[model samples]
Target: MSFLDKAKDFIDKHDEQVDQALEKVGAEVDKRTGHKYTTHIDKGVDEAQKRTGEGDTRP
Candidate 1:
């Protein structure tokens, strides 16, 4: 499979870990920016989490 496919499979298997990592990264970005972009960062994180395991095309 291609790199994107491999990434999708990995995310499908470890969605929770991916979500946690995204949250941690978002929080760090917010902290570094003095919370100025808190709302935007949170929205981005939410969007990313929503698409975590959606790549599964299995029956």
Candidate 2:
């Protein structure tokens, strides 16, 4: 496979990992700074996941 193919595969495989990481990071930030700062943690994670195509849209 070429570089683009390999890169795409990597992203496909690691997308969930990236989303989970962002959730963890966001939670940490919320805990350290207090979520009272008007920042929606869940929304932030959702947006990040959407932008990265890491979000699973299943109910």
TM-score, per-candidate, Cα-based: 0.87, 0.61
Query: What lDDT does model 2 reach?
Result: 0.72
Which regions in candidate 1 have their CA more than 4 angstroms from the true location?
54-59
Candidate 2 runs further than 4 Å off: 1-9, 57-59
lDDT tens string, model 1, 1-59?
Answer: 99999999999998778888888999999999999999999999888888887532212
Q: Give the TM-score (vs. native) of candidate 2.
A: 0.61
lDDT of 2 by residue, 1-56 (tens): 99989876776778877777777888888888777642687778778777664554
- Model 2, position 4, has a per-residue lDDT of 83
lDDT of each: 0.84, 0.72
Weakest 10 consecutive residues, lDDT, candidate 1? 50-59
